[model samples]
Target chain A: MTDRNPMKDQVAIVGLGSTGFSREGGASSLSMALAAATEAITDAGLTAADIDGIVATNEPGASGPEAIAAGLGITEATHHTKPTPVAVFSLLDAARAVFTGAADHVLVVTPVVMGPWNSRRAAADPWRRGARSGILPVPEDATMAAAYAAWASRYIHEFGATKDPFARVAINSRTNAAANPLAAVDTPLSFGAYEAARMIREPLNIYDMDLPVDGADAFVLTSAERARSLPHTPVLIHAATSGIVGKNDEDQLDGLHRTGQHVVVDQLRRTSDIWIDDIDLFYPYEGFTIITLTWFENCGFCPPGEAERFLREHWNDDAQRIEIHGRIPVNTHGGSLSEGATRGTGHLREAVHQLRGTAGARQVDGARAALVTPGGFFFNPQGAVLRTAT
Target chain B: MNGNSEETDEETDDVLIARFAGNGITRDSADHFRGRLDRRLLMARCADCGRWQHPPRPMCPACWSWNMTMDEVSGRGTIHLLMVLHQGPPATGVDYSTGHPVVTVELEEQRALRFTSTVSDDFPAEDLAIGTAVEVEWIERDGTPMPVFRKAAS
Candidate 1:
């Protein structure tokens, strides 16, 4: 076992906690991050002092590692920052922290404002202040919509997929979100709701977008041996990998199909002992419906362009439609679409819930194995395979 | 901010700072020649390499020579790709969409030339194909003639 995968039987997340995901919530990054850290420490039956290591993710204008470390009163471990503000990057940061022997237990967290994206856009778009990039960015709102429009058009022109099939994803996510407390847009989404929307870019309508919200979320990851003594069941981070694929590896946002998550997941499935089909559920970090579809296809869960067809065939009203890939639940905590945006951190918490069986109303029965694929725009992807370590 | 931008009284189109791809330029100046269409020419001549460069740069990439001058070359290039955007408001106004033709015109002198202009609003999508011969048509916008593309007769 020692000679085998070092990460194996090494570290697992035993505790987790988060703060309210709000868009207009006035808490600064430090305030919300601290709030999340405090909750996780208490939940883990420890104190801020117990955490000698801190893994902090830097948001656009938020706290960097030094600030997050000082704020948490933690003096140790590695500090990492991603291009995006998503928490999924922080999850990997914690995994690295525990593996490196730099810290005993690591807490990963990120706090961000969410709400009508138009509002967040005003705050997030740095160029609005005349900080010129020389090259104009295709509008943020219009970018995904345009890509999807082009993709959907190509899919229609090539694979024979139509708008009706694509509508099922929005409906299903909403259906699942209705039960999730963290969900932001859990309303009655109908074909009418999807069709009546104006085209922001081609093919993608308003219904296909995600609501921005404000919030911070954190998860406590510790050694698997220590997790055995914890109060709650532990979900061991079996295999963790982050993938950066697409055009211009450093620049990101080049190729959507070959994202880091897809590459890592493919390697995991091929080399690891478990097949993707064996996984009990998936926590796909979704910012929109198209990203979800693309992940499903790119992960080899389904063939390219067949995501919509798979949903229609499998997601019957009587059946548990949320089990996205071959009956495995995807984003049971309502995903980014339903759950208030945690910038990828929310998905991490959802993975823990399913593993601990503490998911309550949204629990997946007999969920012993779970995978969290967290990502957003530009196809920057990271995935962690977690198992309930007895 | 004006209607048709092409019909505007501005002598030439504003130096369209257009898309900020953010990659720094790598060439130098050669000559500051004006367009044959008339008015305000901007070119670059590498201070070292004796080569004519447009879309002015501070140095010549090929010879690593700073001996470059800024000059205007005939804004003529062949169309690499052209698309008809039936949707979205015109770049210059709110109600009327540019029906503008955004062409990736490969410059006759340099490696690239791509600018936004309204060759036709109603050009069907099928009519536009790869390798269409096109030349620059400066539609006056603001104060400069905005670089646009027109069908170069085969």
Candidate 2:
């Protein structure tokens, strides 16, 4: 395949592993990385000795590639590097390494050891800094939430979208999480509870935010030919891309709340063989409720400014709740909203599980193709389209 | 003992310097234009293309030219979006009383150029809504004037 369809039918996700997600009391970031990487390599019917390349995405301190390689007793890791730190970017980096013949087999790993976000304890925390755009002198804690709130408010005012759809997304995620044994927040969140929850920032309650928990997710990528000999079914990486746009700060903020869907989906369609409607499973990377709504519109599921209405009509049917068999079974692993915030890696892992027909209780039936988007804030939104061998 | 104490003091100085010298929004972007806003607000206009920008930059975004000029303008804007922060305090270490309203104001200078600032606590939350006209009202905190907003008279 050429760059027009780079990695399509060529690179396959041979193995996937996660240090079963937890809210607390797991290993440290480095330990989690090692555990997940070991599991992934073993799951692929290989050992650490077979991995020649490693990509570590944004897990700081002793969790870089060298640390993980040493922890795994991998002495021959010739290719090691860190990407933009976003989880999806790490997967893309690993895939690129394999595609270019720079490495034979590549492992991508990110472990998020969650507790109280102690910015002071870790100086390298990317979120510990102020707004990069300098659009406002926003303090670190208030940077993203405040930005999200503004977008929600503007969206509500413009489209007459209420809190109903936003709250529904929160409820739907928890509902999906209830079946996922590895999900952190699986307790049923009622509609009333969501409406009455304490506002973290106005227009957004505490439930709107992603649950930060201690966990790690890992994936192994090799050539499609090599994947056939592995222990599991190969999930073909059809399209993987990162999207950016040139716009004013205000316009960028709007795009950010939408998870940069316009740029990301357009990029995906250009290179992929299928359109949005063809995918059986969709994983919209969500850190909040409104983000999911924006993804629906940005991914061509609905017209612009019409996601709330679309969800209100098509998504709220009691017989067709967003489950594995429901209309557009989104985020079958509960997503970052309910699944642990391994950044976007958890969603990626979940997509692989469904494509492999091994998602256990949360498996989407006859799931052949899947679309997974991984993004936070607005910046570099990334995504991948995966399909089982046809 | 005297020499050791002197050495300790120098090491502490170095730690402080390194801590504060870490990267963030530079003064040229945030503070350099404060003197201009002391009386009236100003936006940076590209000398090459004459495009205005907020959170002023050293060079033009439109033309990438180093030549930039500040143009005086009305500090008036409309509240495009608004939110109230109630949880943890900001990095500024200021715990606002019962939390306060933070707003994104679409400046009258350019429809796309917006500024994010706080609303004066004196204004009741009920009186505010998106599209409400507001003008800059400087609030002096720790002897530094920061721009906040209040409802503009009809």
Candidate 3:
């Protein structure tokens, strides 16, 4: 098989927009999604009709992409597709679509509404039901919780890392979120408060996980040479790369310090000669606290097993500084933990927001370069580096 | 499983029940189901593929060939990864919101099997490491056997 790296070539994000992050909102996922893309197009000084492709998250059939395109009054061209999940998936798809010459000036959108059901609301939305019910077909053992929990158990055994230190990640994320007006949880927190909050899993608590919100975020990327011509200040896609390892579905549970996310980072870093430390900002798709720790360490942000310590002293470091910023920044948009789950697309939109200097209160000053990494629990992950190529 | 012979419906909650196939898994996995009828834990070895297939399949996932059979594993592995959820055994009507930890064990056959149950009582409170030895167990959920693991026999 040939190694297909769709990240080659350069594209610029000239337009970006998103809806207010929330659950149980006034508009349908489609209408809310349309509003976001339209805003980005308008910001780019391009009429919605100029949009060539629609990259979308969290909708079924042709309804989601077509609806957004139709609402923008743009003709439905070759819109992209990924089984609706998160913002990062849409962003990655948009980049790939652009790379494939599938479309120029692509609009990436994510729409989430806390589904109207108990199980969907309480734990996670059901993907295993239809496939298992023979309503749809999928590979076996594809959606098993015990596999992940068991995998977490394996990480615990090998790394000597436990819940408490990881919980501090949640605390820090929430603390960062407090400064973000767009963040869902406006309430401030203390370490003691985090410790006092009722634990959900032994180590992962209610705070450690991201808030399940309903909304959409959108961005428009074009050729880098045309970036300045667009209405918004565009960020160039310097390099986009994706990787997977060892049937990544359960390989995270395979051995010590071995994870699919890490392999993807290593592959991208090795090929591009761009070390993780050179990254100005990180928009890691945050599903939980452990996810970030794994990325920070495995991506060469720090040596293995030092993620917690590095994060612990992040506030005190001068060498870790990126740009003139006081310290390296991760998830400046309140992240999935704080920003009400931009879904996967949120991570991409946030990266665009930072580069566009439109991230509002959470915008990191002098943020010229940024990295966006999106991952999947069932093992699909893609990462990109977005920078001010001007 | 929704009351069919082709697949088995294992209830994760009142609403969610995952499906298991006896159609394409390995003979060891097939026998594992047989052992399940007697409430025994089972896994498979894809000798050709040189890898273990959990929740096994008839064809080797690695080699993509049907030239594979089942063999009983020693049922020994390590607790390589874990996550303590703030939630519980799926939508159980319990006031205690301190959800149980979810664990994944790397089995002795060199495959990962997932389990969501209370951590073993003997486990430590802080600073846990990876690669701790594990012994598998079955948690009976409404008569269906849900596999869980504890730190190996010390």
| Index of the highest-lDDT prediction | 2
lDDT of each: 0.59, 0.72, 0.59
- DockQ of model 3, rounded to 2 decimals: 0.31
In candidate 3, stretches whose alpha carbon ends up further than 4 angstroms from where it belongs are: A1-9, A58-62, A116-156, A162-165, A271-274, A316-325, A376-378, B1-34, B47-50, B82-86, B89-103, B111-140, B145-154
lDDT of 2 by residue, A1-390 (tens): 256775777888988878777654535677778888888888888888899999987554336787778888886976799776566688788888888898888998888764334323322444322313222334322245466777787778888878987877777778788888878888878878988898877888888878657677788999888999998999988888887565524333533334456777887888898767688888887787777777777787777678767766766456224533244688877778787556788788888999888899887788889888877446657788889898
> What is the number of backbone collisions in each predicted candidate, taken in the order shown?
63, 0, 56
Winner on DockQ (1 vs 2): 2
**Lowest-scoring 10 consecutive residues by lDDT in candidate 1 chain B?**
B21-30
Model 3, C-alpha of B31: deviation from truth (Å): 6.5
Q: What does candidate 1's lDDT look like per residue over A131-207, in tens digits?
A: 22222222211232234443344345455567765566666667777777766666757778777866554455556
lDDT string, candidate 1, B1-154, tens digits: 2122245333333222221111121211111212323543355545455565434555565687655555555666654433333354324432324332344455576553332233533334565544556665555543444455567655
The pairs that clash in candidate 2 are none
Taking the candidates in order, what DockQ does each have? 0.09, 0.31, 0.31
- Candidate 3 residue-wise lDDT, B51-127, digit = tens: 65655556677778666545555657764555555443232222345434444555655545532223454556552
Candidate 3 lDDT tens digits, A19-115: 7676544445677777777877888888766788887664431146666666788875775564445544565577777777888778876666543
Listing every candidate in turn, what is its Cα RMSD in Å to the true structure after a full C-alpha superposition?
7.9, 6.4, 6.2
The TM-score leader among the candidates is: 2
Candidate 2 scores an iRMS of 4.2
Q: Model 1 segments beyond 4 Å from truth?
A: A1-5, A75-84, A114-117, A120-156, A249-261, A318-320, A324-326, A376-379, B1-91, B94-120, B125-154
